[model samples]
Target: MLVLFLIATTSSVGFAQIYDLGGMYTYHYRDGRYSDWGDFSLHGSRIAIDELNESGVLGGARIRMTNENTIDYHCWPENAALMAETLMKKGILVLTGAGCSGPAVDIARVAEKYKIPVISNGSNASMLSSAEEFPYFVRVVSPSEQYEGYLINVAAHFGVEEIAYFYTTDAWGLGARDVIHEYTQQRDINIAQEYSYPRDTPYDEIKSYMNKVKQAGIRHIVNTSPTPDTVMIFRALHELEMNEPGYSFYAAEMISADEAPEVVAGSLGYFAPMVELVPSPKLSQFRDALEKRLGKPVDPSSKAFFYGALSYDHMLAVGYAIRDIQDAGESVTSQNMMTYLRRMDFDGTTGHVSLVRGTNDRANMPIQIVNSHGYKDNGTTVDFVSVGRVDPATGELILNEDSIVWPGNVTTPPKQ
Candidate 1:
C-alpha cells in the first residue's frame, strides 16, 4: 500500500527523461501482524534516490520508484512473481526487494524471465547463491553459508564439544542447518541432538522441545529460526529454567533486541553480516535524515536499521550501473544494467561492496557477532552490543571476551 514517486529537476536545455524502478516490500502479514522493516527499507532506497538526483549523476535522467506492498501475501512465492510481472509491464528498468527468502526466490525468477536486475537486502538463502539458477538476481547481504561458521567457532572458543541444533523446516532454516552441519564436521564439533520445527510452532510446543533438550542434558544449543520464533525459543528456555549460567545458545539469525529483551538477555549472541554503525558525521547525518523521515528516533542497535544500510547500498549499486551506462553513451537497458552490476565494486555505506562474478553475492563481507543485554552506561536500558566478529577475508572468529556479559550478568563464559 506504499507508493512513492520521485522526480528530478533537469536543466532548461533538455527535457527530463524518466525511468521506472520497482519495489516489492513486506509491510505486514496476512494475519494483520505489522512490521516496520518494509518502511525502513523503503526510506533507505529513497535516500539513495535523493542523492542520485541531487548529485546529477544521470544528467537529464530522473528515476521514478514505485513500491508494492506484499500484504496478505507476505513471503508467498506466487504473489511476488506476480507483483514483479505487474511492475515489468510498466517498463521498470530494475527491481528491488521481496525481503523474505520465499518471495525473494520467485522475484528472482521473474527477473530472469524479464532480463532485469533485481537486488535485495534481506534474502540470504544459500540456494540463491547459484548463478545458474538466478542470473539477474543480486543481494547486498551475504548468504547463510557466509556466517554459519561463527556458530561453530563460538562453540569451539568456549570448549564446547557437543551442542543441540534447532532449526525451522524452511528454506532459510534448512539452508543454515546444512551449512552449520558442514562447519561443525570441519571443526570436529558434535551435534548431540537435532530438532526441526515447523514455522509458527506455538510456544507450548517449543517448551516441549526444550524439555527434550533438557532431558538430553544438552546445555549448548545453536538455533537457526526466524527472529520471532527465536524469541519464543528464548521464552521457552526461560520458563524451563534453562537460561542459567551454564546454558549457551548461539543463533544464526539476528534476534530483535526490542522484542523480548528480558528473555534473550543472557544467552550466546547471534551472527549478523551488517555494518556496525560507528560514530561518524556521515552516520549522524544518515540517522538524522532517517529519523526525520520516520518521525521517530532511530535505534542504532536494531537489525532493521542495519538492513536500511544494505538497502541504501542496493540502490546505490543500481545508480552506479546507470551512471556507467550513460557515461559510455549507451542506452540504459536491462541487459546493460546487469552487465555492469555483475562486476560492480565500490565503497558503500555498509563497507567495501563487491559482487562475486558468478553468484552475484557480496564477497568477503564481515560478520558481526552481537548479544543483547543491559547497556553498560545504564543497566536498565537493554540493547545489542558487539562482542566479537568474523573476519571477512580469513573467516577467523575474534571475540572481545572481556566485553561480553553472560547470563545473570556473569563475566565469565558458562562451564560446559
Candidate 2:
C-alpha cells in the first residue's frame, strides 16, 4: 500500500501542467523469502522524474506518480488485472515495474483495455516481444528469445559442448526453460539435462537434482531462476563440494553481478563467465544522476547498481512520451502514448531503444558476453573482474585466458 506521487515541477504548477503516472509493483514472498525489488524501481523512477524537472522538459508541467503494489498473492493474471484496472481508473497510463512475467502479462491485458503503457525493466518474458499480444506493454530489458540465441552461442565459444538448462516452474522460469531448450536444440547443442523443479522446492531437493546432473557430466551449466533461488542453489553446491576447478556456470543475465545481493558473493555459482548490457551515452547521463543521488558509482561495471540503468530508461521514456503529449496539445490517453512511444527514438539512459516498426519489440543495444569471474572472501566483497568480451555480431568471446580465476585458487581458464 505504499504509493508515492512524484510531482516534477519546482513550484507553482497549474493543475493542467502535471501528468499522473502509475507504478504497479510486483512485490511479495516466494518460497520463504521477501524480495523488495519494487523499492528499486520506485526509487529509480523518482530519480528520473526529478532529473526531467531539473532539465525543464515539462516547461512547468510536473509528473505526479501513484504507486500500486500487487502483493503477487497467486502469481497469476487476476492479481495483475486488479492492480492495473485500479491504476487506469485513476487516469494513469504510463506505469512502471511489473518485475515478472505473469503479472506483466496480465498488466498488459489491462493496458490494452485502457490504452495505457506498462513499462518495466524486469519484464523479459519472451512473449512480451509480440506486438499483437501485449501492445501496450513495453519493457526496457531485452527479451529472453533475443538473448537466448546469443547466450547459447556465447556458451559454445567457451568450449562448452555439453550444457544443462535448469529452471523453476514459475512463468518466467518455464518460459526460459522452454525457449533455451528450443534454441539449443536448433543449434544441435547437447542439452545434457533439462532439470525442472517447483518454484518452492527446498534447497536440499535442488541439490539432489544437481547431483543427478553432476553424474551426467554437465561441466558447464546455465541456470535460469530467480536470484534468491540461484543464491540458495549456489549455497547447496558449495556445501556439496560440487563447485570445483572444472565447473562453470551462468545465472540470470538480466540481473547484473553488481546488483546481486551480498549472500551471492562467496558462492561459487555466482562467480563465472559474464554478459554485459550497454545503454546509450544519453541514457548513461540520466543513469549517472540517479547513481550519484543514490551514492553509487555511475560506471556500468561498478556493480553497485544492476537493474537501475534499464529501469532508469523506462522512467525517461515515460517522461519523454508525456512531454511529447503536452507539447503536441493532445490528451494524455493510452492511444496517444502508444503512438508516440512506438514512433519515439532517442538515446535514453539505457541506450538507443527503438520500438521496432509494426512490432512492439525494442531494437535493443548490442549485448556482450564477457569472460568474467569473481572471487569473494566474504559476503560483501567480490573480486569481480572481466578479462574479455564477446563480439555480439560474431559471438566470439575474446578472453584473456591468463586472467581467469579458476576454483582451487587457480588463475587460468580450464584447458579447452
Report every candidate's CA lDDT: 0.74, 0.63
lDDT of 2 by residue, 117-149 (tens): 887766777777788887887776666765555
Models 1 onward score TM values of 0.89, 0.82
lDDT of 2 at 50: 82
Which residue pairs show backbone clashes in model 1? none
Candidate 1 vs. true structure, TM-score: 0.89
lDDT of 2 at 26: 36
- In model 2, state the lDDT of residue 17: 63
Q: Write the per-residue lDDT of candidate 1 for residues 1-416, one digit (tens) a residue.
A: 12222222224435777777888765554434555566677788888888888889888787768544222345445566787888877778888766677678777888998998888877888988988899888888778887666767877888988988889887778888889899899888999988898777888988898899999998888888776677677777777877667766787656543454445553434333345555566566677878988888877777778877778878888898888899999999988988888767887777778877688588877677777564435443346788887777887778888777665556778786
Task: After superposing candidate 2 on the true structure, give the runs of residues whose Cα lies further than 4 Å from its correct spot.
Answer: 1-13, 26-38, 67-78, 254-288, 295-304, 370-372, 375-379, 387-403, 407-409
